[model samples]
Target: MRTGGKRTASVFLLLTVLLLLLFYCNLALGTRFFSPAKLFSLLSQGRGNDPAVSILFKIRLPRALMALFLGGALAVSGFLLQTYFANPIAGPFVLGVSSGARLAVALCMMLFMAQNRALSSFALVFAAFLGSLVSLGILLAVSQRVRQMAGLLVAGIMIGYICSAATDFLLSFAADSEIVSLHSWSQGSFSGMSLAQVRTAAVLIGISAFALLFLAKPLAAVQLGESYAESLGVNVRRMRSALIILASLLAATVTAFAGPVSFVGVASPFLIQSLLKSNKPLLVLPASFLGGAVFCLASDLIARTAFQPTELALSTVTSFFGAPIVLWLLVKRRGK
Candidate 1:
């Protein structure tokens, strides 16, 4: 319709292509590489009892799907936080939501191991959600005290550090035998995703994402400020509460499965907004979700392939790229 709209449309098309390309690369390239032709052949043959087929079906496909859903959910969650706080830097990791979730999951895992009990998926999500809410509560309280956005951000980072320290403290008391497994989860990963886990993430993230979409209009109004949003008939208090719950739920889901993959939440929304050149929630939300899927899929690919036999943690790669973007944003904001 307009020049900006055409630009946004073109950007969306480019992101879609990039997402597909990254998805294929993640499935095809790993410790053992599979050519695109081979990947197609394996999949086309009804996935018979072949080892490569098993790897494709059981490992790569599930892992890729997990990245798409959880990564998108994390991004959408971050956008929700950013909208709620009117801060570009606000995200699950930056605000300590992921750290809190990680801490809770670690505690649950340690407790289960100590008692020789297995932790269920539902229990893991519940623990993570509880911890995320705890962190969000502290964040909101701190936000009230801080007049400047930077002050709030610093407080959020401090909260994250405290949660991380607590997690490390708990790990120190873990049994030596259990340390390896717990350590892996704490580092954040997309590995070992089963079909069941994928299905579960899909349902949780799908619902959360759609719910967010439903709130897009109100959220956009909220972004304009509480007074403006109220003038527009948006219930500011209820909207904020919903944002917190939905954002926390999505963050908890990611933390529960992948142990808090970093920076996707922060980076994706900003990147999409830049490309879209618009802040309209209807456009930004969907683009951010796709961009997030691409970001994590690419990061997961690097995590798996960069070190070859020993995989780098998913958060490691994300933070490497994400932290700089954040610094640049802070600098740009200051420039203004």
Candidate 2:
């Protein structure tokens, strides 16, 4: 057992190193050519008449930072939801939270654009929060009477469909320009992230991530079964509520900043679990965050550079990788 534990720790450390390297590489490579040598020199020299330095500092940094926080937030949310629901396939989107966020964002964008009013970033964030909470409330109500995980999942999907229908109805009545904006927002992109937005996301995601870390032990206990957790002196109800709130906040913030970049919340935790060969939240949670950051950064790189001069949607890149993995996991579990 000790040997196995040591191996797991080593693998996690190696992956963490690789993730950090990829992050720096993302910083180095972009549309503009900033050679590694020049980038290093510019950083060391403080302020210089270097256009590359300015671009890196102003443009690339924010986008890369946004990817990091958004990825971490999605992965952490995935981990919490999976553990709480005891379903490997469970995710933030599974509970209709992302759909709720989409609805709120759609309504806000349509109303603001139609009124010719400038929409503040805060308004967008608040809209996402409100939408996610509405879905969460419905899910919680259903869960109270439905003891089966499968039943809860169905409730979530039904809620998602309802929200989607409502969003489509609103879009039909919206102005052409508003519809265009909504379509773009739904596709999900990390581009055009300002430093201020990145900073805000980072702070919110950071705090939420820390909260998850602190609850890791309790979460693992709850995974054994709520009654078992209670026997161990764990407040199952409080922990469950905290997990929902944390996951909702994490998902809402990421959707608000990065748009509804799907599958990260469904895929990242599973990837980390496979890598570590363990479901202990203490191990899975942090590893999922790092894995998520790596996955998103790599996906963004492909989205930007895959088809020269033509950027792809972030969702498209992620889905190409995420869909196959999810199918494989489903088949493998079914065969067992």
Candidate 3:
């Protein structure tokens, strides 16, 4: 067991270094590869009349940073949801939170577009948050009646389909130009993120991440069951409330910026737990966050370069990878 623990710690260290390298790779290697040294020089100095430098700053950096923050947020949200529900498969995407957020954001976008008003970034996030809460409310109500985990999951999926249908119906009535924009976003591409949006996300996600970490102990206690958690002096109700709000905010932020990414939330925690061979919350949370960052960064890289001129949506690449992991998990659980 000690040897296995050492190996997992080593893996975490390796992943951290790999994540840093991926950051640079995402910045420098694209359709046109910039030398690492050149990137350093560009950053060290300023973008003094160089169009490439502008592309580097105005495009790649923000996207990579978005992938980092939103990806980590999505995974942590999944961890919280899974912990709360005591189900391995429970997550923002699987529970319809992402789709709910997407529907809300889509409606907001259509309204803004119809009025010829530009939608602010924070407005999109707020809309998504409200949508996430609505979906969460429905899921919680369903949970009270659903006796089995399968029934709960089925209900969640139904909610997702309903939201997706609503989003599609709304888009059908939107202007052609606006539809084009909304369609790309709804499909989940991490392109076109700006520095200002990144700053906002960083600040918000940062505070939330810290709050989550602070609750790690309570979260772990809750995993055993509400009665057990309360016996240990953890306020089960408040803990659950925090979990729902934090998970919703995290999910909403991702949907707001990157659209509805599939499966990362459901997959990252499993992958991280497998690597660590432990379910301790303190260890799992950070490892899960890093795993998520790596997954999204790699997925984003493939999305941009895999099809050359035709960049795929971020979710396409993630779904290609994440879906299989989810399937494998289901099969493994069934076998167990």
Candidate 4:
């Protein structure tokens, strides 16, 4: 047991080091070059006329931070959902929460763009939150009486399909310009994130992540079944409600800020579980967060620098990496 614990600790340490290295690489590389020392100097002092510093500090920095927090939030949210549902494939997007947010944002953008009124980023984010909450409410209602996890999962999928259909209808009927804006938002980009946007994402994700930490034990207990958890003094109903809310909040916040980034939530927890060889939420949640941040940061680096002059869509980049991982997980589990 001691040897196993030591090996786990060693692996975690290695992952931590790798994550830090990726984060530094995110800060160091961009469209314009900025060495580590120079970037540090500019951040500590001020960039007067150096466009590299401006790009690094103003553009790349915030975007990278946003990606980190948003990715971590999504992964942790996925972890909670998988734990709650006892399904390895469960994730935030699977529940239609992200689609709900996308639907709301599409409407908000269509309304404002049509009227030539400026829509605050915060307002768009709030609309997404509202949409996610509505979907979450429906899921909670169904889950309360459904009893069967498979039935609840089916209901979530139906809700997602409904939201997707609505979003498509809106796009089909909207003006060309509004459609363009909505399309870009849905495709998901980390570009153009201001510091204020980063701060908002940080606060929301931080709060939700902290709340989830408190539920780690209960969530683990939940895996044995609700009645089993209740026998151990866990309040199954309250625990589920809190977990759902936290997962929704994390998913909504990330979707609102980063435009429904694909697959990190689904990928990260599964990856961590594979690495750890255990289903313990206590270990899984934090590892998922770190793994998510590392994945996003590394992907963002490739998206920005892979083509050098032109930037790639963040979602496309993630999908390139995430889809295969998801498929492999499914296949591997099927084999087991």
Candidate 5:
């Protein structure tokens, strides 16, 4: 095998190892620690009214799996946005997509709570997807006027602020009961994940991720430039649309489930590309998915365990680490 292929293979192997290790840690090191052998025995045995089994299957296991799937979805979404915008820093969060999704989900939740009705998972995802498209549309319009990538980024940030403010305004009118749920979701979290929710997220994310993988070759060509891709018989417009829809869908699913996790979208792809030393979509796509899983698993672990019974919001931990990496990227880009 070629040296580059070998390196990519090695990186994937390392990321897989890290992903497994973090997944294990997430399951093992919660408020109650479980040993590896005990965890295995519990997993292999019947539940039969065992609290530990319940904790493992119902609580810790679902949470860990949610992080794995949704984190990967968020990262892949970010990579798609970055590729589409031809900007390394462009992401669902930075581009206001997550905020848009958050706003929509918040509205959906508020409406349902006002009616004393439950919001279905499908409805939640649809609201978020619609919100993401709205945000993406606004950014696309702004991008036309603001030619500079920096200006577009600032505009995206401003859009995010506007959505967040609107969400806050909505929150002010929410009943106390509503606020408890909305407040937790608005802050971003991976808690309270059920097997059902995990199944929904897994199905949505898995399909979207597979679609993106299928388009990896064409997306690579698109990244080279639209005209170039078109010259190669790729329908650049259709490809771009697919990119937008798929990216939005992935971002929306994450927001619907996890309340708009920050930084994983931007940081994971950048880290993967840097580590892989290549920007080819075929290589970066899968690696970024795995990298994102590892990133969120590790972050989720820290968020819950760092305070010991006082869990921090997932976004807080992500931003703490991700923000520095973004700043460093900006500085490095400026130097270049």
Candidate 6:
């Protein structure tokens, strides 16, 4: 195999191994540890009256699967945004898309709670999707006037700040009861995930990923330049719109389920691209998905276990690893 191809294969193999290992770790090692053989035996019995079975099926399994799917969704969303913006660091979180979704979900939850009604999974997803669109809309408007990519990034950061501040303000007026519920979600976590919710997220992310795979050719073309893409018969406007919607959908689905995860989006794609030594969309897209799953599983494992009974928020672990990667990318790009 060619050097780049060999590198790609090696990296992908490594990511897959890590993903499986971490998936096992997330399930087998928790407040109560389960050995691999025991976990397998529990699974074979199917839902039973045993407490260990309940923990395995109802809790650990669902949480692990959610992290696997949602983590991939976040990374794919980030990859799509980076392609659209032609900026390596561009991602849903950095661009305020996730924040927008978070704000919407928070608002929806608060309203539903006030009415003494609970939001269905689908309703939360819809609300998050709407918020993501709104954030992207604002970012697009800023892009129109801000000629420089750096300026547009700065604007995105400001928009994120504004949305976050709005969320906090809303929280201040919320009931203590509401605060207790929202506080846990707002901090970001994979805890409390259910099998039904996992199905919802998996279906949504599955569809988005399917669409993304088909868009790879045009995405690569657009990455080179709009003019080149146009020459290749790619409708730049339609492609741009599709990219925005897909990115938003992926980000929204994740936020709807896991609150707002940090850094997986930005860090995963960069690491994947660097490892593969290529920017080819088809190659990077799937690899980024796997890389993201591994990253999140590792981070989540650390977050829960690092403090024993006291668990850290998901973002706390992600930012700890993700921030330095972002900083390195910034400094490396600035020199070029």
Give Cα-based local distance difference scores for all models.
Answer: 0.90, 0.83, 0.91, 0.82, 0.93, 0.92
Candidate 6 lDDT tens digits, 60-135: 8999998899999899999989988989899989999999999999999999999999899989999999999999
After superposition on all C-alphas, the RMSD of every candidate to the true structure, in Å, is 1.4, 2.3, 1.2, 2.5, 0.9, 0.9
Error of 5 at 71 (Å): 0.6
- How many residue pairs of model 1 clash at the backbone? 0
Q: Candidate 4's residue-wise lDDT over 1-336, tens digit each?
A: 888677668758977997888877888876556687887788887657877767777887898888788888889988888877778777877777888988888888888888999877668778888898898788878988998766886788899889989988989998887777677677787778888888888888878777877888888888878889999999998998788778878888888777877778898888888888877887888888888888888888898899978878888998899989888977987799
Cα lDDT of candidate 5 equals: 0.93
How many clashes would you count in candidate 5? 0
Highest-scoring model, lDDT? 5
lDDT rank, highest first? 5, 6, 3, 1, 2, 4
Please write out the lDDT profile of model 2 over residues 1-336, one tens digit for every residue. 998799788868977887877777777876776677877776687666777767777777788888888888888888888877888878877778888988888888888887899777777878888898899898889999998887898899899888878988998998877777676667778888888988788778878877876798888888888899899999988998898889888888888877777788888889888878898887887788888888898888888778958989998998899878878878987899
TM-score of model 3 relative to the true fold?
A: 0.97
lDDT of 1 by residue, 1-336 (tens): 699878988988998998999999988997678898898898798558778988998999999999988888899899989988888899999999999999999999989999999887878889999999999999898777887888888898899999999999999999998899888888999898898889888888888877876799998887778899899999999999999999999999999999988888998999899888888889988888889999999999999998889889888999999999988888988899
lDDT tens readout by residue for model 3, 261-325: 99999999998888888888888888888989899998998899878888998888899999999
TM-score of each: 0.96, 0.91, 0.97, 0.90, 0.98, 0.98
Candidate 1 residue 125 C-alpha distance from true site, Å: 1.2
TM-score of candidate 2 against the unseen true structure: 0.91
Better of 2 and 6 by lDDT: 6
The lowest-lDDT stretch of 10 consecutive residues in candidate 3 is: 44-53
